[model samples]
Target: MKARNKRLILVGSGVALLVAAVALVLSAFQQNLVFFHTPSEVAAGKAPTGKTFRIGGMVEEGSIAREADGLTVRFAITDTAKIIPVTYRGTLPDLFKEGKGAVVQGRLEGGVFRATEVLAKHDENYMPPEAAHAVEQAQKAAQTVSQ
Candidate 1:
């Protein structure tokens, strides 16, 4: 085989391998990706039905109910206009509290969210930007609907 022809074949093979590697990495990343949605989005049926995802909003007041088991707790997450019921069966973050902002990652089950992980704000007035934006948008939508 000619030397130039051999070099061309090697370069093409290297490019093909690089492309395959990048595709593999992207597919793996996509499988692990979890999207974030607000309570209003979940209530509107916009969230994935059974896939793992994240929901962020304010924990509703007077809606927290701890089960007999020390680790099980149910509460409502609200984005000002809508609420989603969430159940967590693990130790909650110390910052987790009603009327505070929280982000929970989990899947939806029978209209309720089963949270596998919970993230609460680090301090007072430190709401996550996405949660705050969602709440503001929900409130605006509610006002528009009322008018």
Candidate 2:
């Protein structure tokens, strides 16, 4: 084979290997990634079924329920468009309260979100961007429904 042909073959193999490496890395990252979703999206079946994800929204008022044990708490997340029930069995953050913005990371099962982690906004005026966006989206949806 000519020298130029040999060089081309080597370069082609390197490019193929690089592409494969990148694809493999991306696949692994995707599996570990927790995507953000709003209650409205979950209600619309846009959220994954079993895969873990982050959901951000306002904690529905008058929806928090504590189990007899006190550790297991259940509440509903709302984006104004829809509500998603969430259950968490752990000490909640001090900021966690009804009618506040929160982000929960967990999986959905049987229409209930089983949260492994929960984060609440710290102050009255402070809210995560994800939570803010979700709230805005939900408000828009609510307006559309009312129209």
Candidate 3:
């Protein structure tokens, strides 16, 4: 092939490879992307099923329960307007407590959330932005209903 043709071919191949690399990166990112939802959103059927996601809200008071083996714990996460039952089979964080802000990552199955990981507030004043917004919205909704 002529020198010019060879250069053109090389440039075309490089462009094609770059495009392929970008597409692969995007596909991987999409597959690994996790979404956050509130209890109200989950209850409204807005959460993705059969895929991992995050649910943020306050751990409902009087909803924490432990099994006989002590490895499994069940609790309810609430946005004040709706609640979702979550089951976790691992040690909880020291800061985790009922009525405290939490973000649980897991999948919903059989009307319950099977948590793979649970995140608690880092400090006394810390609350996930999504959870805070959810609580605020729920409160506003409750006030609207009562008035």
Candidate 4:
């Protein structure tokens, strides 16, 4: 091949490889991406079903129930406007408590959230941004309805 043709081929091959790399990176990113939702959104069917996602809210007061197995527990998460039932079969964080900010990662199954992981607020003054926003919105909505 002529020198000019060789240069064009090299450039074309490099572009193709780069495009392939970019596509792979994008695909991986999409697969790993997880979305955060609130109890209201999940109840309204805004959250995707059968896919891994996260829900953030307060662990409703007096909703925690532990089974005889001791490892399995069920509770309800609430945003003041809505509630979602969650079941987890593992050790909970020390900070996990009813009426406190909590986030659970799991899939919605048969009207319940089967949590694979749970996260709790680190301090009294700290809550996840998504949970805080959800709680704020719920309070505003409640006020609007009472007026």
- Put the candidates in TM-score order, highest first: 3, 4, 1, 2
Backbone clash tally (model 2): 0
Using all chains and alpha carbons, the TM-scores for the candidates as numbered come to 0.89, 0.80, 0.95, 0.93
Considering only N, C-alpha and C atoms within 3 Å, which residue pairs clash in candidate 1?
none
| Pairs that collide, model 2 | none
What's the candidate order when arranged by decreasing lDDT? 4, 3, 1, 2
Residue-level lDDT for 58 in candidate 3: 94
- What is the Cα-based lDDT of residue 79 in candidate 3? 94
Q: What are the Cα lDDT values of the candidates?
A: 0.95, 0.92, 0.96, 0.97
Could you tell me the lDDT of residue 82 within candidate 2?
A: 86
lDDT of 3 by residue, 8-80 (tens): 9999999999999999999999999999999999999999989999999999999999999888999999999
- Model 2 C-alpha lDDT per residue in residues 1-147, reported as the tens digit of each score: 999999999999999999999999999998899999989889889999889999999999999999999799999998877899999999999999999999999999999999999999988988779878888977886788899
Global fold similarity of model 2 (TM-score): 0.80
Q: Please identify model 1 stretches exceeding 4 Å from their true place.
A: 144-147
Report how far residue 85 has shifted in candidate 1, in Å. 0.5
Worst 10 residues of 1 by lDDT: 41-50
Model 4, 1-147: lDDT tens digits are 899999999999999999999999999999999999999999999999899999999999999999999999999999999999999999999999999999999999999999999999999988899999999999999999999
